[model samples]
Target: MKYYIGLDIGGTTIKCGLVDETGKIIEKDSVKTSIKGEEILQNIETIVSQFKSEKPITAIGVSAPGIVQKDGFMTTGGAIKDFFGINLKEEIEKRTDIKTTVENDANAAAFAEQWKGNAIGFHNYYCMVVGTGIGGGLIINDQIYRGGHGMAGELGMMSVMNVDNDQHLELNSLSFTGATVFGLLNYYNHHSDKPEVTDARVIYELADKKDKLALESLDFFYTALAKGIINLMVALDPEIVLIGGGISANSQFMEGLQAKIADLKSRNSDVRDLTFAEVKPAKLRNDAGIIGAVYRAIQAN
Candidate 1:
């Protein structure tokens, strides 16, 4: 059976897999991304060659943490400085000898979920990712809505305040995730005479203890997230918003987020009838990016 390959590149590592139409990972593996040279492309080639050994794949898909141009080259990836303006498609294909398609990682994940996962029935909604940063994707009538320059639904970059006469308000790209992670870790550090601690997961693990500081940390996260959602509701009016990423896996935060949204809606009449996106776990989980990448590559090819 013919299969497709998907590659998800991150700051420190790369995850790639072979996926069929059934959304199964026929083969999966990871490798360190040696960004110092052209070895990044070599790493991807290695993964592709291994997967192709047993199965005849038709095309390749790349879920990059950058803006994917229509031609499948990368325009910009905020966290990774080297990938900016790089033609990832050509570089990979030159080594692998296969046609490749590229897309923003968050966009690819959202696309995967929309087509095969939780939001299967929704045509108009938003996909919010809450891991390293809050990234967003908009789906309108079953299509990924990339504004003119393939730069739509970048909710993380949305503005939230004005610092000066010339400066308007803006939310930090990864502030929500960082704040949520640090707020809890900082509290735990004060309670214990231990070494430094950092990680969003650490925060969640400690939430059940109901530590005053941990609760407060959660409060801070939900407040900002609520405001962000409100801002989105006011502007996009999407029918539903699916939450993805590692952080969204926690039910405690999800419950708190719901309460905050309810409170915010009660205060505004125009938004009184509005509802938060039907928040739920991304069915594809880590596989969303790979599956979405495969979808993009297939369509492009």
Candidate 2:
């Protein structure tokens, strides 16, 4: 009946949860991530102190972005400039005197899917999270594959399109730029004079209504997403690619991505011959980072 404190650190928010060994969330809370390194540590200390005050905690696990080492050393913080070159494990352990483990956020999500959600009993798969930007986790042979420097699975930086135009194409140049929710909204607003679209659902709804701009924007998104999925499939040859994020809730997004893949297969005989990995939405949504972080802590302990 031991409990673990799990922290899911992101650019905007830090989600903290007290989770049991069985992957059940006993209690959860969150706080804004401060840009300053010390403030971020203070926020984590506050949350961990509150959780510890109420329950007996064995260890702490954290899911973070950028290059996170097995020893919890963050060499490069993707969005949080303050975390660069910090050993977060020692920082938390010194304050709380509890063993801690840290993992990359996307890798943690992939582990969550294998542990208690979709991709259960699967040996190999890739997990991709699409949001402001794309994040990916590669699981090969049932284990998270951190590259030589523990910086693997960065799918967003992959170059997908190089559309040549007289105007600057920097906005839609990369895979992440073309396939993300922010990209969709930006593209939509860039084209139309209407009030800027805030939510991805608005774009989806407009597409469903046969709005030409919406449809065109979504078409670009699906094409880029399909190419990214194919790139993973061809490179990793995983059994399936589990997609997770806010937009994964929408059924049409998956359908659209699949349609693009199908179209690719129809035209490219090699793609047809080499069976692409099946794409499925992640069963666990936001709680994935918590569960997976707890899982990593337990395993490390």
Candidate 3:
């Protein structure tokens, strides 16, 4: 019986797990992510060493927050400054003498869904993670598409709004600014005098209570997100768009987003393309990255 090490590296923590071939996590734990690259690598090595002491590990799979190439070369570290332009696969393999695989965090989540979660058996889909910003992954024809430079799934960078000549206009138009929790908070704090909501859930709660300001903020967010979804549908015509993130857990938000999309399509005949794509919440939740990393390692082996 062979086991693999799965690591999901985030800005705040590094989640490590020992996974079997069938995606079962035998043991899992996490450590704080080090600000320095070398210390982070050491932490991973410690975890791997501990896991190896108990089992016969065959390979490792890492999910990182950045522009990770198929070969595990990170072009830009999303939040970890020290990881920029580093070849994570080579580093880990050299240190552990085990086969290693790496993938972008969002791509890992998408792959996990296709392999064992919501999108199981689906051939074409897009996975969008709405965290502080938006991150996206494409699974087309049953394969992950990383684009030419392994940076294709940057859906957040897409511009959804057009405004007059103002420096703030460009930032406001970005999908990241329009659709994410951080964006919602920014909008709520800047536009309304309702004590400055901190969490996105607070806005949702207020909207549920029929607070006008909260309702308006959510309306703006849903509208922007609906526009982005329509644009994706028009471009790729994917079978489904899986929404991933903490906010996706909100049934009201998902329902509202779907309703808004329907409403937008009905109003604009040109966006008839939206009907071709379905929107649903992702199923894997927090474990998606770990499971997907194991799957990637399995494939590499």
| After superposition, candidate 2 runs with Cα above 4 Å error | 163-175
Query: Residue 257 CA error for candidate 1 (Å)?
Result: 1.7
Q: Model 2: number of clashes?
A: 0
Q: How far is candidate 2 from the true structure (C-alpha RMSD, Å)?
A: 2.0
Model 2 Cα lDDT, one tens digit per residue, 115-159: 988989889998888877778889999889998988788887776
RMSD of 3: 2.1
Candidate 1, 15-85: lDDT as tens digits: 89998866677878888866653677777777888988978888998888867776876788656767787
Which is the better candidate, 1 or 2, if ranked by lDDT? Answer: 2
TM-score of 1: 0.87
CA deviation > 4 Å runs, candidate 1:
35-37, 161-194
**Each model's lDDT:** 0.74, 0.84, 0.85
lDDT of 1: 0.74
Reference-based TM-score, model 3: 0.92
